[model samples]
Target: MPQPQPNLTRRGLFGNGLWAAVVAGITGLSAYLFGRTKQAKTVWQIDPDKCVACGNCATYCVLELSAVKCVQVYAMCGYCDLCTGYLDPDPKKLDTGAENELCPTGAIERVFVEDPYFEYNIKEELCIACGKCVKGCEAFGNGSLFLQVRHDRCLRCNECSIAAACPSQAFRRVPADDPYLLKGAKESKPAGESKGIA
Candidate 1:
């Protein structure tokens, strides 16, 4: 007659439980690790109000070409025919002529927006981040044009290199959900609204 083996043992139960626990733990850990790795990196951003358009953006960036670029606030623009930002700093003529334009790369495009108002558009492809257009606009225009870093070009380092070199200290971190702190149509006038930067 053959001897029957024991069906269940304390050792067998303990060993099976241990393996189950380990596998469950591993699965949980893998899910957590995968989620963390899939998340995007948060990075420093520019506050348009604090930016002085000092032309530092052109030289301070790590890349050969700066990630900063001038952006137009169409809603705030006067669209003047004789835009100081578009024309030469001291040009005898203030038209679309290349010689008279303030932008070194002719990145600013002017469109007629009825009498006494002209719509200015930025040609970002031509922009070199020199900030001449921003400077001119801030000084003479509505202070609408400003610079911001393109997230695609930004490395999102733990400590931003451009922030260190920025004279205005305009750089700040924002939540990943609300990446850009752009101005709304209605500007807030509350005294407490001045603290946060985009």
Candidate 2:
């Protein structure tokens, strides 16, 4: 005897189609979410020229140690012997001594380059981003020293605490690939320079 053939019902086909559609929708949603997660995101950075050395960077950052650090623009630096950034306002002597140092952390190192000239470099590890040195530099020197967000140390928070509290509004979002807004870069002219002006 021959066996009976199974029935091919329209309801069964409809049910299979609905299940396929549900799985397809779920897969599409997952792909979209994964792509969004992989998308490149910008990070907050400080424009050195715009930064006012307000001392907020040290205090407002969410991290225990602020991500901001003082970077020297060598091209703008005068390399003076009596660097205001290196020494306190009224030092007992014009010497590279710990007592006379302006930086509370002694982050600025003065190397004897030559007579009447000293090479100053910031020790990033010791920096507190207090802007004390920056204030002194801008006040008395060529404003070679400026604060910048050290991306390597930065947490890249969705809403940066330092940016929210910045008085000068120096913070801006920059591409993650090229985050730094370096000083003395020749791509753009300085603040006062123009095509017709001297």
Candidate 3:
């Protein structure tokens, strides 16, 4: 004769249901937290004060063309006739020709603002984020030229590849409301007063 089957008690069935509910609750909470982590993300910026002009910003960005671009703090700029940022060291001549220009892409635009003073601007469309201009400007002239992340072109990846590769650890997060970390967004010292960045 076959043995009788065990009774299906109501209490046992309730206990099973309770255990299933606990597991589901935990899974749902995990999913919610994952979403929250993504939602609470911050925007990226370059801390101009810490940048070493390492050339990593040009090569390491995930974007086909890096989001990094050079910015000029006109307040700090001397408006020199011979802008070291625009022209090579011992340029053949002080002219706009590619031969005389230091920028690999010829992105620096020199404009005559007045006698003995010229205005320099970056051609964003042509910039390659190489930091050559930044290095030149910082080394021999007023430290007015600096690299900044162009948010318009930035993908805003969860982890920026450029930041990881930066030797100086210059990249940082800023509030979305005020994302830019421009060198001279505020007033700066007179040209050549200090070599230190900031």
Candidate 4:
């Protein structure tokens, strides 16, 4: 007959039981976390005030068409016929001509609102996010035109390539609920009010 097996002490049993429980808890937590899809709480956006219109948004996005687009703040617009943003510097005439237009893609449309006042409109579908018009507006006009990421076309990538390439650090993550960080009214936006493009 075999000798009686040495019995496990109460302390040994408790310790072993505790260790198993700890291991099981950790494994369960890991599996639960691994199986869940982590929803992003934020999205990439451009800070119009901080942006220098460095032209990175036009080329660095990981999409065939860049999500960045020129948006107009109509309240801030001067509505001059000779819009610096719409026309090349000292163009032969103010009429809509390819050579005279500042936009390479001809995305900006000069609408006849009245005499000596034309409403500049952006052809969003044709825009290439080049920032050429934006730079011109800021430099020579009323600084009403600026760049913003259009969520309608944006992929909302985990890491935005345009943001990384931005020289001005203008790209940043904004709350998903409020994806846009658009410019306020021409005078002010009441100090923290989020605005939208017209």
Candidate 5:
């Protein structure tokens, strides 16, 4: 009888190599497609125009400290010694009395930038997303104080929980390259007129 052909023949080597190459190629394509799809869906955004500043974002957020924060519009600020947003809604005087402050978290820091002009800054660490500052600014000042999503603290979920609970439906998905939807140049008209009014 003829000797059995060697199991490890030239045909076996060629077939095994071809199959390995094909498997690798398929895996590479699958990874590429998965990456592309993931990139397309990675969007996290907040619409300052529609935010009601109701303080829901502070508590409703999934993070321990709400990823949403109140930002300032320095130019629009009247720099009044008595900021309605910063001070108590019904204040006894324009003093730094906690009782007279509107911020539940006391996150807004008011500094005397100059005579008749004060610099208003947000202490993000202290901000609780109550929107008191935004409301105060919108009501009296130029509407400069607005709410934004802090990406570092933000989980960047596929569907943000805050967006779902948003009263005004101000949340949206934006391109990953430019995630933060800053107030545009033309759109910047002080805080009171910018957007996100009650």
Candidate 6:
């Protein structure tokens, strides 16, 4: 003997259709959100041209040690033996002694490259991002030294404290793929040339 089929109700059909619609809407929304999550994000970066070395990076960073550090533009560096950036203004002797160093933490290391040129390397571990070296380099020498945010150390906060405190408004949201704003990289002339001459 064959069994009879259950009755199909309009209410049940409408309820099922509504449930299907809700599921489809939820799925579509989830897909959209997932795709958005994969989209490229912008990270905070300093535009070297706009930066005024205001010393805010040291004071305003949320991290105990600021993510910002001094970087040398080697192409622009004059490589002088008596580097104003490396030595204090009034050093008793042009020596590599800690007392004579401009960096409070002695982060900048002067290495003999050749005859009169010396290569300055920054020890990031010791850097305080105080901008003292950067200021000195920009004012007296080739302006090779500049401050940049170390992405590895940066928290990438939604609202960067250092950025908020920057007086020059140098901080900007740059694409994460190319976040750094390097100095001397774009210039056609050597960085040692005086302004307007280049």
| Candidate 4 all-Cα RMSD | 6.6
Off by over 4 Å in 6: 1-39, 187-198
lDDT of 3 at 171: 80
Q: On a 0 to 100 scale, what is the lDDT of residue 43 in model 6?
A: 78
List, residue by residue over 1-198, the lDDT tens digit for candidate 6.
876457657888899999999999999999989886742777787778888888999989999999999998898999988898999999978889988999999999999989988999999999999999999898899989999999999999988898888888788776677667798664652332111110
Comparison by TM-score, 1 against 5, better one: 5
- Give the candidates in order of TM-score, highest first: 3, 4, 6, 2, 5, 1
As for TM-score, the candidate ahead, 2 or 5, is: 2
- Tens-place lDDT per residue, model 5, 37-116, is 63354455677777778888988888888998888766666788877778887898777778888888778887887877
Clashing pairs in 5: 49-196, 88-100, 142-191, 142-192, 143-191, 143-192, 144-191
- Judged by lDDT relative to the true structure, which candidate is superior, 2 or 3? 2
Report lDDT (Cα) of residue 110, candidate 5.
79
TM for every model, in the order presented, reads 0.69, 0.74, 0.77, 0.77, 0.72, 0.75
TM-score of 3: 0.77
lDDT value, candidate 4, whole model: 0.84
- Give per-residue lDDT, candidate 2, residue 126: 94
Better of 2 and 6 by TM-score: 6
**Among all windows of ten consecutive residues in candidate 3, which has the lowest summed lDDT?**
189-198
What's the lDDT for residue 101 in model 4? 96
Name every residue pair that clashes in candidate 3.
Answer: none
Evaluate residue 102 in candidate 2 and report its C-alpha lDDT on the 0 to 100 scale: 96
lDDT of 3 by residue, 1-198 (tens): 976567757888899899999999999999988876632445788878889888888899998889999988898899998998999998999989999999999998999999999999989988888999899999989989999999899998877899888888788776555667777663442222112121
Cα RMSD of all models vs. native, in order, equals 7.3, 8.0, 7.5, 6.6, 7.4, 8.0
Rate residue 98 of model 3 by lDDT.
94
Least accurate stretch of 10 residues (summed lDDT) in model 4? 189-198
lDDT of 5 at 64: 80
Instruction: State how far residue 117 of model 1 sits from its true place (Å).
Output: 2.5
Candidate 1: stretches off by over 4 Å: 1-41, 184-198
What number of clashing residue pairs does each candidate have, in the order they appear? Answer: 2, 0, 0, 0, 7, 0
